[model samples]
Target: MAAYLYESSVEPHAMPGNATASAGRVGDTSPNTLGAFCESPGQPYDGLPCAADSSTCEDRAQECHGRGPLFDKDLAASGELGGYGFASNREVGRRQVAGVREAMGLQGGKGGMRPVRSAHAYVDMGGYEFALANGTRVRTCPAAMGAFSFAGGTTDGPGAFDFVQGDNKTEGEQNPFWELVKVFITPPPSKEQAACQAPKPILLNRGFAHKPYEWAPSTVDVQMFRVGNLVMVIVPGEPTTMAGRRLREAVHARLVSSGIFDEQDDETHVVIVGTANTYTHYATTREEYAVQRYEGASTLFGPHTLEAYIDKYTSMVPFLANGVQGPDWERPQPPSDAPPKEQILKAISMQTDVKFDAAPFRKQFGQALEDVQSEPYRAGETVWARFVGANPRNNLLLEGTFLAVERLDAAGTWVMVKSDSHPSTVYRWQRESTILGTSSVRISWTIGSDTPAGTYRLRYFGDSKSLGGKISAFVGTSGNFTVG
Candidate 1:
């Protein structure tokens, strides 16, 4: 019995010309100080003649530049991480930890951290660009996936939630449909990254604003990072060398101490960092803090060095490792008395019709059948199942299910594959379903172009109490679609 871990990031598509407008708490006030890019008057901006006086020309000029005027006003602006109104990664990380611990039966009673048969996590890096006088360029933070590796589960999972879609959906449909599922908070698959269209002015306007003299961000980049239970976010700060690194360390420490690691101590951990979520300010190291010093000093951690910086990190790690505990955050464990097999089967079949694909089943079954020289039609695979619903109304009905698919291979050996069954929008019951959602477990394998083609049978089992007695389907295969 193996468990799987998933991770990913969520971002609203506010790009221009989008069918619907985007909305949410876009910008909110942040701490007086952000990461390391110190905020104060007289900070140099692109070598422009910044006035030395604090309350006079310098601060006033910064306040005056609203949308443009480029560099001078930009001097006061730190990176976007410092100002946005998004859920803090520190909090997200803590919740993930608590959820898993409770789910595995480790938090309450006498049970310690339970062994996870598998783990999956995903994070969203807001975007790839950050603003500096020269121009926007690629930025990387420690936790944006580059920092660690994820083990124990499949890499494929749901992509980041579409905030733009949520905005367009009626209130009745605004459930956190994709919230708890895990995705890999990975880097842009390639350098040709996707850019969000400019958001509607209203959506853009919701961000933090500048005071008479206070600093603000001209742009934002949001990225998500995940390693095992840890989800790290790199928010851009004012473009100070130290801002990004320092903030990352602080937030990372906070999450580690929040019980994320402790909850999954037995599993191999991974870390994904970089700019993927909304770009906040850059989190820089102590060395960067010293080299490119700025007034944002108060915002940057004091002591200005990596050794000192790491020390601060160690202290907060505990908080991030063990989160605030109460009954509400606990995940439900399987009841002591296992339900009847019928109930389990029903639960497995309880999925709504999503566009389905027979590829996964075909591949897994095909491989086994070919290997053993048995007919692929009879051999099948079974997968463990779990259901995760967006709301409580469907919670009991959708939370967990086990899936078992079986077939006989070319040889007589009965091949079975089991997955901790779960629902996803990607799996469509048929190719032409009107609605789009994620569900289904696909198991696939490839045959060479020259290999013999034949008909096959793929059978699937959805075993869970919530399914209400639906029967599994069988797909008869035709010629192999193997590419030469």
Candidate 2:
């Protein structure tokens, strides 16, 4: 099959509510006219780029913010400070769709795909030892988050504090207050541990801290899947561009040498499938690790992390060779050490359970608090309705929606045209009175330019919990409004 590769951005940060927004755009099959690639960087307070090393503006990370293509427009339209980034998210998704279409058009499909083969293993990354290609022996340290992790987060979400990224300060140069606080949170790293994670000034010695449970994963899942000449390296964490490229090359070379695919086979492809199976954090090239940026600082297993993964994945290539299949196929021995089952069993959750939900006296659940306007609304205008609501945690509404935008058809029936899944639709819940157990929900829809001109109504579906904790469903409908 024809293969196409596109590298639009490195470490493209995600925005709030973007998960549903982007998914909606990708699912929408509508034609798009947006450009195929758009580079979005953090918006600077003074309209200048953020500091290269710390990603800060005036030495303050909170001043640097990521801006989407439609950031200003969305912010102005919503009037919500620090806009949700929905507009930009959808635009990016549209660009992705356009890119896919262009790529497919340029290279038509050709099929001779091979059967799928897979391999998986659970490895304790702590102290994993191996030899580099140059005959240098090295090992990975236990998982530990560095001070730069708190370097006011990333451009995607700037955090509080005086910390900054790319911080490689020696102990004396480090913040004296935080240095004392670190001892109270988790045990201070020993000299050996500190040396192992050199250049990464430990903020939290997660692997060594096991009070409530394992703070960081000591064991991670390593897996791979092969189809035809294409091999996917399933990684446990995010891998930077260079790190991922090195991994792919290492695996590709191994596959060629193993005779699974000849070096002359130009069709052979290896790709990195990141953040799969488990989470360890980020993987960066040794050079990037040395730089100690946000990504490199978050590289849990020290500077040798990428090399360790490359070594493990390359060693497992022989298992994916042709004819390695079925019950008859003999597999190598499994690792003796696996992650402790208690690590999960003893895991703790700080989130409190839903107590109960109730509507104000004489205001029944799902009762309309603010109905839609009677006047006609034009395309691109937003219409909304608010209702007395309950704690939605009472019912997640899986395979269902909390709200819908219905269009009145010629047959005199309301047809569900849009749900909460649509990028243009939003479902927001707010607690009005915690003591009274009262809440409200606002459902809004931004009418698309291409939306059909007709009468439409807003509907809300909710579930309320009684004093005894019984959940009952309710529905509310708003009066019809014209879209012209």
Candidate 3:
């Protein structure tokens, strides 16, 4: 189910509703036309080819119009570091996905539902929240928000959990993307953003300081990945269509280079948009952007739009290539860097096996399994499942999976996969199945000697059967379960 609670009465549209007034008279000029927004220079970085103070209209016309070449020069100078080239953003995105799929090798004899799903958004302007029927409530947003970019009341507020959810308002020389990314992929104690309000460093005592560059920040965009119902979140910076396309291409290029999809359904892998989070921006065709118009020339989207395009164009891939067919779907082979299948499943099981000091299950179950089916999982110690009948955006059945990671590589780099490994298993209902309207499966697992005795989880990846299947479905419950 998809539900959308707009902050304003205005709906999401291609063109701005208040454009006429905000923009000059029709003949005078468009509000955000190529001449105004694109051709006009924008905020200049220290060495990017741009006019001094290119952040405003005045700068665009006076200094930027002529000096803008400097910005292009900077891009050329930085080369791959600036997220440029055919092998840049698109290549990176594609590689990341391939790496994830390679990392999550399927396991368990394929007869049960697995937690696997993906989430897409044109932009996550106001952020969003989700509560699985199991009572698992997860809230996500850009690492930082502010008056200029994210446009929410500044300050993480008194109840702020951590800088992970705070607002970033520092203009110029501050890279919110990098800050969030560092916190995401790397270790903890990620520095708090330069606060928009008081704008001061928090708990930062680094011995050295660094200069800002027009480089991709650590916080790329946040991606929701699922294998059956098990879900993991990878939030990166907003992907511009072409810009983000590099990331997507990166994955595909790897698959092609690594020969993962050669014998399988190459046409089946796809991308989709318009759901869950709306964190990125405009997406145009290569021909479209070449026009050098407003939408086409948007720097934000220009560098990142490829990801969105992939989402739109490839929406049907998972369903055709990986969705349930002949009763189940199988994950492809793992890369040399992937984790072991046993380890992945064990970790997934542990996430589901969350323990509680008190009686968590009694309070949740109450009576019938149906009663517990409508809510998310409270902290407990059983392999529990919840299904929501609707989503906030589409009001359709919402489904997803979440679990924990048991072990990282010794270097703590990427996940370590075992020989012939896959992370989770997926199952679909057949005409002869007996689990009510659902399908069923049985899995046999052996905890590795290296596995620490703790809570683990097993999840079924969630995938939307709608909208071309490029986008990942939301998490919710459609029915209850009685272990037979």
Candidate 4:
């Protein structure tokens, strides 16, 4: 089945702290903190600046490193890269599991089966300083996010067939989609960065920006809790795999040495959970940040980001060693930095008062352009239906329903078999006429090899945009047919 192939191809190996593997049961409540990773960041963004420079940019870039005629010692010291604009601009961080697995002729998603997984280094320097456009110096919380994505950007690059995996050497500012992302992210540097200078731009989540003046603290809180031999380290933002591995090792070693558990005790376990509690941003080994990929660029604390956690967690280990107790540490945080109301766009932006004035040969809103093909369908066959639609924003279909693949049950009632999220199902939306606010929705199911024989049908539910200043809901059905 396509679902099985997709899962088997990407299942993660046993990662330290928590294991990510096979898809199993759903709908489970979370347990309390069994253990935690507690760290308080010392210096804010010490490693945020450019730790190194590209020789090519130094020699070739015009006005590189903040309005320079070249040769500013500050360039290397600040890590402020020019020509490309951002201090560090790397694509998404690497996932060595699948790549390495394929290279060695091993099946994908089997890395966890092998013991002694790879380990990565975590580091943090003191602090960083860089010069601004007006020659004034400023400090920032070292961080980065969403680098030039591989498999094409939102609008630029080849659409679905994009094979270019992306590169750090290439300048992303040249990307056509880069401007579009900026519109949404509103990244600092140049225009707005200069216009507003209170807190560094990194404070905003708009990738590699700033540490706001109102931040709770510069030190990231390293937290931990142990229930029996199970220990959990709660990390702020997303930590890379290598960072997770090192943290797990450090914590597990302490659990054994401190007499919390015997080295041979198979029951002892430690896990590193990210974005678990309070949010400081990302933690990458200094090596990872040095690459300036999306992960490094998004790493906020500083290069020594991982070091900050290791040092703190190592020191705080005694609390959960064997007998240590009491809640004397900070826990993971919920999102409180909710953006202002104005920043969020409402649904009306996507909706128009225009009625469905069908020009010439067009299907009306919510009308089925084509019904499901008559079926004596075999397993592995594909089925779909097309219907007239309005902008989905008019009705998000969240928690509710959109399209469904149903089978006639023994009781003669139609029992739902699949929805859009099913691996075999695809929901395609198209703007047939943006001006008329007319759109189309296509729901499809690729019958898998294991699909059971049945009388099945496709159903589409939509909210039609109206011309009389109201939106109305409608449904279209494929009518029943047999599949075996």
Candidate 5:
């Protein structure tokens, strides 16, 4: 039997008397500003630290785990529900919300806001050649994953086996087993290709592998959006901190030099929006690429990837100018390249369809199996209920929630104060019997300190499929409980 769980949090309400501003300034912040790190020797190896370079403890990558700010907090003792990482996730989200609120408060109104402008183009990155600022000719190789890519993944999601991160070994230094077997998986990198990806030690030459369909993207979207002095660089892949900084700085300088923004009076802001139009993989700085860490190994292209991106983005800056002179001026034409429409249309999925859903004998879908406690709950306490459920995969419920926390208002009406999207709530699913097709869902909400005293109930919404292939929606609500 297979089971699924979905966790969400309660939304934070805005403070009363804080009116919305018409305009505000957008600024860029370093992605590394958050104070958090992956903690090694998690759980089984609790007191030990992973090896510095490989992020492994006792030669096992599974021991390394990412920890949040509240990693030390006991979930049960604190009346919260979730696994090891939930507490930290909650704390990180809270910090981000606080930061956004502060930025909102610093808004100066919409008086100085500029008109919205945008630029877009498609570029084929495979063997893309360009010259650096120093006039040194460079070219990005076809998409390929390096040896470190199989280094047991990253700390966030550790992989099994003997692989570890930062493994930028040369062909001669690599494992003999992998060296012998890699040719069977994908074509071995050619001599020129091997030299192009110098220190990477190619593990998967995806660019050359095109059998059933394309393995990696060859063409990617280069897009940018501008509103007044702020520019958003839409990146096709995840960029490391240093790579993002370098790209932003280069774009900002280009905007100034291209006269899109005045250097003397206007302050230009550039931010990187990653994983925008397509998934090319990760982009890392040259130095980081040399280290061949997880991000660098997954860079797809060679060490010149970031430089190529910077070159492309800056070259398009003039297109973002507010016309050639005034509003009547026309923008320049963008670089032309065909998108990978065939690759998208031919995409395949291995996921199986949900044949049907069936509840236990004498039970109905959405029927309450376990109700909430009758006693009153206090701040920081958790309230939960379980219900007979169906396969959630039947319907994604896009823009809709499967669980909600309703409060009894003064008018005798149930008002939804929280949904599955909230951080304080968790929805867990378990399959009791696969042959019988019986399943259950548990919904829990941990009351926040700021939650007002009132009567509340947990409500679950679901869709079930019948033997005849008909689908129906249902709702289940638990007994009302008081919060004091």
Candidate 6:
């Protein structure tokens, strides 16, 4: 739900009177970091070991909330991988797109691709030790951490504790992905591997962990784009609320101190746009990180995550100091060694066609049974429409809307006034019966009190699958109506 809203909310409605932005996933530290420090399996809320049959959200949430900026003994000791290593290639390592392991020097071998290991790895198969930045070292192994991240799981997502809607913390712990992923959880190592791991403590998955910043390119670059007095700091990761707040303050302070603006000047404003440029990881305050929740465990840069970001932004202040072309102490950063080339994983389709036994239940994919309501709607009222829906994957609607409310313009341009991204708008999909290949879509727009009085229409765009198993796109429009 959050990921779907991110592009629509962040890209379009960042300005005042815009859409609300929510975040979902982030490019952060290896998932193993959590198991090592947090994932208290079978531990109940009262800190007592769970009985034979018990594991609740209260137990999980209580155990995890406010845990860290805690140090990973293994990752901290791991240090950086040395030598002219490989340069990062997102194409070869898509998972590393957002400052993941490959960028942190986990892909430090000689070549253009990050090293790959079998899911059944039993040792430090990913070369996590010499794989980090040049000067770091680690006692833990990656395969062990892989087991924890992939096998043992954590608090969020396929984690052991995730709860579904309406779940009251009393349901059993089970994730949908567990069945498909359990095999990948590296099996317990052999005698030698076990010996290597025996000396190491805090093996969350009975494996190792990756230090976030152990890479040759330790100092990351900060990008600032300004249009007039509005300065935007584009960070590499999904910085926490605190991280964003501090960044704004630091940039604002720099601009004011450099004589670019007066104190608390109305003409100047600064904001932080996280998950920009290259993906680093989470940026949290030393305080928040202390309670290692999902955010802290993912704060790859340790306790001073925000402080490091502040310094990075401060260094770039020289650039924003004298305008866009001012002195940049860190521009044209020196290049590092190239990463090794390795084959990356590709997507495989497993979709099959469904044959409907009844002619009426047979949907030619994009057939709509219930069209939108056609009538005058006043402010505070909701407009609804239902359609014969198909798989939305046929048309992802990237940087686009699945639904739109257009208000006719003076010259009849039909400008887009509202979209599925709007807070008051809702789009839902349901398969009335998968065996019958019958499905329906519901879209609703609760007119805001401030909505302009005008004629408007709702538009829904989707894709349908043909009997021959071919998927194609289609659109449905609602009748125009007046809003008063």
Best by lDDT: 5
- Cα lDDT tens digits, model 5, 1-484, are 0000111122235212233221111111222222223344245656555666877776777777654456566234554554545666555555655655676578453466467777888988887899998999999999899884555677666766677788888988877888888899889899999889878999899999997788888889999888877788999988887888899889988888888877875456787888778888788889989988788888898989999999999988887887644442356657858876566567787997777788888988888899999899999888999999988888888778999999999999999988776667888888888887789999999898989999999999999888888889999889999999
Off by over 4 Å in 2: 1-45, 77-82, 106-113, 327-342
Pairs clashing within candidate 5: 8-422, 9-421, 9-422, 9-423, 9-424, 10-422, 10-423, 10-424, 23-110
How many residue pairs in model 1 have overlapping backbones? Answer: 172
TM-score of each: 0.22, 0.87, 0.22, 0.53, 0.87, 0.47
Model 1 — TM-score against the truth?
0.22
lDDT of each: 0.27, 0.76, 0.28, 0.49, 0.77, 0.48
Give the per-residue lDDT of model 1 (tens digit) for 254-301.
554554554344442333233333333333343432222122121122
- Residue-level lDDT tens digits of model 3 in 259-371: 43443543423232222233233333444334323333221323223433333323322432333334322443211122212222223222321111111233211111222
Give the C-alpha lDDT of model 4: 0.49
Please identify which of the two predictions, 1 or 6, would achieve the higher lDDT against the true structure.
6
- What are the runs in model 5 whose C-alpha is more than 4 Å off? 1-45, 74-79, 107-113, 325-330
Worst 10 residues of 4 by lDDT: 24-33
- Give one digit per residue, the lDDT tens place, for model 4 in 263-353: 9877667877677434555566667665544345445554555665665566566655433333333322221222312322322344444
Looking at model 2, the pairs that clash are none
Give the per-residue lDDT digits (tens) of candidate 6, residues 1-484.
Answer: 2232333333554412432332322333332222322335564434333221112244343243111223232224331211111111111122322333233455322344421111000111222223122444333222222212222223324344332111212102334354235424423344555343332111122222222312211234456665556667777678876667777888788878877656855656676777754444566665655444445444444454466556546555545443334223433322222332222333334775344311135554334566555667888677777777765655678778888888998897898777775656678777777766666777778787878888888878777666666656677777788898
User: Could you tell which candidate, 3 or 4, scores higher by TM-score?
Assistant: 4
lDDT of 3: 0.28
User: Of the pair 2 and 3, which is ahead by lDDT?
Assistant: 2
Worst 10 residues of 3 by lDDT: 19-28
lDDT of 1 at 467: 29
Per-model root-mean-square deviation over C-alphas: 22.8, 6.7, 26.1, 16.2, 5.4, 16.4
Question: Which scores better on TM-score, 5 or 6?
Answer: 5
Candidate 1, 171: how far from true, in Å? 32
